[model samples]
Target: MLTGGPLDVLTGDYLAELTMLILGRDRLRNPDLGYAKTFLRQLEEGLGLAHERGVRIVANAGGLNPAGLADAVRALADKVGVPVRVAHVEGDDLMRLGAAEVPEVPEGPGEGLPAGASGEALAGAWAGALTANAYLGGAGITACLRAGADVVVTGRVTDAALVSGPAAWWFGWGPEEYDRLAGAVVAGHVLECGTQATGGNYAFFTAHDVRRPGFPLAEVWEDGSAVVTKHPGTGGVVSPGTVTAQLLYETQGARYLGPDVTARLDTVRLTPDGEDRVRISGTVGEPPPDTLKVGVTRVGGWRNEVVFVLTGLDVEAKAELVREQLADALAGAAGVSWTLARTDHADADTQETASALLRLVVRDPSPDRVGRELTGAAVELALASYPGFHVTAPPGPAQPYGVFTSALVPAASVPHTAVLPDGTRLRVGGGAGPGTAAPHDPRLPAGHGTASGADPLPGPGVEPAVPVAGGGGVGGSPAGPPRHDPTTRAPLGLLAGARSGDKGGDANIGVWVEGDAAWEWLRDTLTVEFLRRLLPETAPLAVTRHELPRLRALNFTVAGILGDGVASGHRFDPQAKALGEWLRARHVDIPTRLLPPTPEGNHP
Candidate 1:
């Protein structure tokens, strides 16, 4: 914002599900420490300039304490000798209302199943309850903005609300404006992660200058259509590919649901307005769910882990020895687990080779058991353990783990409200009506088949199949002879760009091609069977694929890869942030025709 020139409003999104738990812990330690400290630090430096320029600020840095954050901002304004009107949106802290009062909602593929539920494997995860804050909407923020406040601090509002609130007030849109609100939501989703829309964490890294990519900005017009762009002379490229990648990032399914509106992503359209700007239009929105989603955090049990590395020959044997020793030492230890991962090779090479990791983790209801008993059992074998066995590091004191469960509360139960500078409280109503869960199928393109959520299947398309030489075309394509040049085994990135992220226990991988020629190959080549071949880890799990021809992208939903959400997941890529890059690295048979004739290896 410092270099991006004057702006009508500025929003900072600082809350995530994990962040809420962390902040709750902090609040437990010190009442005044719940709000994000970084936000205040940034405000101290920029508040004066922002106030001077009439740039309003809205942020969810108010974590578990919006009132406290508002007080700090007011104090800062006094210290800086500026008369600023600061207001905060509150009433999202559902713990104050009691847990039993809030009804639990059914968790879908996006939100992981609630602990102890039939489908959820990890029951009794949230035995010890902590803080539960409902994800809020923009009504309060918009009210604060309309009330002449210079800054609005909110607690746990949906990230998209920060942008939509200002846009709603600026456009004077009513509560029933679904399409326009959905369009604004698309803009907000792109800009919520700052530089993400400007090519940060993109699969095709070499295509853009990401060294110091500029932040994204949405120029929303009167009609709700927005042109996503970055400041001129920015480090990154803001093309259709980058914007679409950000759109698909971290989304649970095609329908982007928030407290304000449920956007139909498949219906949204993107077009190039000019250089470094993409026009977002044709977005349809539905009424938000009647119930508000709240993240419930509880003390999941105490846990400790130790990693032992086995080097050189007999790597597997060494791991087995360690496991055997641990099993003997902790014979009666309950909830103790060990995983032997082979990161070794047979051939002689550097020390990094022929090294395997034996990871041991133990959890118990009693913190003392995990802190002392678990650690002692592992250390007892240190002297008489397998040869070349070395611990990665000392196991620190057992730490408390948090289990996250998402539930829905009636909109009226929370009494959503906004507090003004003069102590005036304004009631903020939730959006129009009850929301409907949209059907999403990742196994096939929209027009090709059935979704898991009982969506009606579309009639089959009658496009002619292209002939290829190999009897087996990738993704089970029928073939006779070569239609293009000979095929070569290469990474899928040779022809496409990808973006991926996690939603609870599931991971969504969105792969897209630039032009019609590449897209034709991508849609046919990267089918569910082919994706399973590329990433064998997803082979055992149920995989769903969805095709968006308008964006020239195919989205695949990998189920249960992350055991749970980021908090207790055992996978190395817990959130599956790197799943896309890993898929791009997997080698595949690429038709030689897809390769560029140029030296730079750019797609034709």
Candidate 2:
């Protein structure tokens, strides 16, 4: 982006929940190999150009070891003859602490934790955790920048911190500047995932060119608002819809809590600014909570799977027979799950088309139990199994999987240190002000301590009722009268767009629509009860709904849906990336006015 546009800083995010676990394992084998190696390779090619253009770099490529990565970067710069000052943020690791020293989990919004999610549980996890890193704010990065560092490497700071830290340093923003800081947080969120804000994985991807979407950049101003855009002639297009879609990805509730600030997502306003540019403004901010979220990961157990293909006649009968056979073989397994996918036709043309798959997944604490023993059983069945018995691939030995969980620690407890280029260690304070505390206003929702026992909405500033364009009552929709507009049963995607993702063991699906009429209809129609009917799996889980009327969006969070986060492989869609698409595919009664015009015989 620096070569393509007038950029002052370049940030790269190369860490995720799974990456931390992988890096932790890397450190176990070799202490010097914990950071992302790909980042070093990228720097070898781009560092010179970045330094020549006076563009500073910031990244969270230092997965489990920031200091080690910092030294590596300095060595690479020296080898390439680039005199760039590199700094790193540390002290996020909590693995050194004993179980008794682990802090309790904080209670508030954004934490849609499942049952048994408590401080005691977190402490127990910490005792056996392979990796425990606190999610720090941007204060350390700011300290590094103020110390004249050209490159900043962080361990596990919030993803948005990359953009906010740079914006704070450039604008000289103080901790008390919550509104401006919050604006930077929103902008940072839009750009954190790189191409997502520019149309990658967008619900309406077919509406624009996204084959090779370019990375996104935010032009953050002094007041904290930013213009999200990419370089000229980039592959993707940026508009209100794209930006809004990104704003909702993997996020819960309207009050997006962070270490730096609590950004009011409901107050955010998006406007088009020419082509491939969207103006993001009006995002209010509140003081951050007094605690920091810490992500703890550990090896849960060994897991293995095998897929059996049954083609042609009696697919269901064939699947049942295999299930009965495997039930005895896997009886010794700690946990076993089976899924049958009938992808066959009665009078099919090709062998591939007339096939069904029966998958068996087994988990156990012992590698031998879930590995060779299970694989041997499945392989032995190849000769005695039903007709047309074939497997997709030979089942391999079981692999160790990781489990992710979150804990909260007092902000003052965890040290935030910045090792500057001059070998000077600087202590960075928390972003919350001296007397600031988590809000407990009665007007706030239930999770925030409201006394009315009413359902909790995310954050504050939620109006008692959403106002409709035409004269009407209140609440989710206009109560005065119901419009008897002609309706057709069609996919919900026809009128609304959705984005879903995982956060630890929980998953969030943010759904939105354009136009006031559509919003009114959606907000009223898609309630928790209705959603349970549409997606049966969510029926038994704890789901919370929050409204962002300003954005015409409703976000639903399902706790325990992902079963111990992405690494556990608990469900078919472990990350729930396509959960929204599944919802959109379910047929629902839709107002004809909300459906987009389409060519005859073509579905919307």
Q: How much is the lDDT of residue 37 in candidate 2?
A: 87
lDDT of each: 0.74, 0.82
Alpha carbon lDDT at 554, candidate 1: 75
Best-performing candidate as measured by TM-score: 2
- Per-residue CA lDDT of model 2 for 438-521, tens digit only, reads 444343322221112233332332222422121112123323356788998988987788999999999999899888999888
Off by over 4 Å in 1: 98-127, 330-349, 432-486, 597-604
- For model 2, the superposed segments whose C-alpha errors exceed 4 Å read 98-124, 433-481, 599-604
Model 1 score (lDDT): 0.74
TM-score of 1: 0.86
Taking all chains together, each candidate's TM-score versus the true structure is 0.86, 0.91
Instruction: Give lDDT: candidate 2, residue 363.
Output: 82
TM-score of 2: 0.91
